[model samples]
Target: MMKKTNYSYIGIAFIILVFGILFVPKIVDRISNNDITRKESRSDQKLKNKALKQSDLVFIENTNNGENRRVPAFSFVNQYGKQVTNKDYEGKVYVIEFFFTTCPTICPRMNNNLVQIQNTFEDFEDFGVASFTINPEYDTQEVLKNYASTYDITNPNWHLLTGDKAAIYKLANEGFYIYAAENSAIEGGFEHSGNFALIDKNGFIRSRKDAFGNPIIYYRGITSEEEGTDDNGEVEQISILKEDIKKLLNE
Candidate 1:
């Protein structure tokens, strides 16, 4: 009887020992793996949130010919004779527009808008503005220089760029998503639409605006315009977009 009792006690102890050996490591491993997974999940969520917020941004639509579209890689030289590429404006709010120096209608208003923007952020050092002339052939460095002088655009942050006709057209169509084409025969040398493209710091198309909050054009570039521009059209012109830049700079 004593032997049997001892054996029974030993059996219970062995069972408990076996359970501790088998279950403890598994529990520890599960918990450790869960922690790692949760950390990764949080990191991934942050990236996703950034991307989604980028998508929510609104910018002037890219009018390819007449239809709205997204822009492609644009490269040009500013009045200062520096090669300006899409890569230069990363991590900053960039105001891009398609215009010629001699434009009688929309170009002047666009420049005025840019001038106001320069004044608004005269003290701001992070944001930037770039304007591309559709008539690159006539709007050469000298022509741009005269135009810049006329507007008193002294801000070092502003760039008036002129480059190869094909390159500029490509940039207008591809980089900035504007209606730009080479037509020396035309009175202006080239014909393109009037649109101001507002790009966020991440280099994604955020919102496109006309003179004011007018929804003359709107496209996000990643998705269809009809779909992408729907959610963002409610926000007033440059006001919300400008605030976004301020918030980003603050961050």
Candidate 2:
């Protein structure tokens, strides 16, 4: 009986040793490879994406009235020679830029970035662009049309617009708060902001907040995604702009 009891204890000890040798290393290996934590992290990310909210973006406000700022009403002739107004862009997400076809620098880069953006959302009918030419006198219907063709502007909603110079300037300066003036001293014989304004489907200007939680009113358009940063060491915002555009579209 004593020998039988000792043999039973030895048998139980052997089984425990075999179990540790067979399974313990695999569990340790899984932990070392982060197999368990990785799945948990992916699940957490999915939950966060599902909870996306409209508050992720900021509504640019009118400093004077402290109300949400909106794109002012305006009328202009598009590259196709059709009249377009603020009402035309209702229920659409569009980017606004002040550029002329004859610009010697910056304009091309800006438009190239815009072209990339246009292609990114080619399937979305509500995505559009409004290129208001500061030099309306020179960028007539024909010139704007040719420029659009050269840049491969395929989006039907993209409108290279030109009209009364004063109205365009008013739209640029007072309406959008983007600087635009006839400056012969500049290389392009005109001066305008190289930033782009983002408008939501409701015609209200929208933008993402900065590091300090302040609305970054406009996106830098001069730097391309490939460039990442310009000669002046300014970081590119095109990627972030695209992300924000998606956020608004989903909203």
Candidate 3:
């Protein structure tokens, strides 16, 4: 009986030890997974809040220009035979994009997305969209008018602008911090990229974003380009660009 009791005690001890070894690992794994999940949740929340934090600043400093200059003004025309200057649209929301009617690729997709923007803000009288033709010489008012018609872009708030090549190039380089180089072979105008310059009601350039990703500002045009091998690339991507625009509009 003594020996049997001793054996029984030994068996109980072994069982307890095995159970503890198995249970501890699962407990530890559960803690580690929970910690990781918590961290990720916090990170996502931070990005959400950052996107919501808009700015009231009128102007943002740009470094793309050779002189690291601020955009002061631009002189261009709308398709309706009206002259437009940067000063004309003070305290109104607008967007400016670069393109020619003859772009063989990318521009079409960008414009299709832009149409969604045009329709979205058509009712907002204070908002407008402007597209400037890099090939101003060929993109006559008539050409722009026809193009606008094809897209059903009849919003009075929208403007398809064309002007002298020299002035447009200057505006592209100096005013908007965009590069519109004159390439002989490309049809509609110059070799330009796809970018959108977002300006606020205060005549200040607040944000520059891509043609497709951002919300359209019923006031301007859009542009696109392939800078490098298309692997997670962001060319002239403005930091806090969207937030800055929102801030200006809200203010």
Which of the numbered candidates is closest to the native, going by highest lDDT? 2
Models ranked on TM-score: 2, 1, 3
Q: What's the TM-score of every candidate structure?
A: 0.61, 0.79, 0.59
After the best TM-score superposition of candidate 2, give how far the Cα of residue 251 lies from its true spot, in angstroms.
1.1
Cα deviation at 132, candidate 3, in Å, is 1.1
Q: Write the per-residue lDDT of candidate 2 for residues 129-179, one digit (tens) a residue.
A: 999999988999999999999999999999999999999999999999999
Q: Rate the local accuracy (lDDT) of all candidates.
A: 0.68, 0.94, 0.66
On the 0 to 100 scale, the lDDT of residue 187 in model 2 is 94
User: For candidate 1, what is the TM-score?
Assistant: 0.61
Q: Compose the digit string of candidate 1's lDDT tens values, residues 141-198.
A: 8889889999989787678989887777777776655787757786755667755666
Whichever of 2 and 3 has more lDDT, that candidate is: 2
Q: Relative to the unseen true structure, what is the C-alpha lDDT of residue 155 in candidate 3, on a scale of 0 to 100? A: 71
What number of clashing residue pairs does each candidate have, in the order they appear?
12, 0, 22
Report the error of model 3 at residue 51, Å. Answer: 18
lDDT ranking of the models: 2, 1, 3
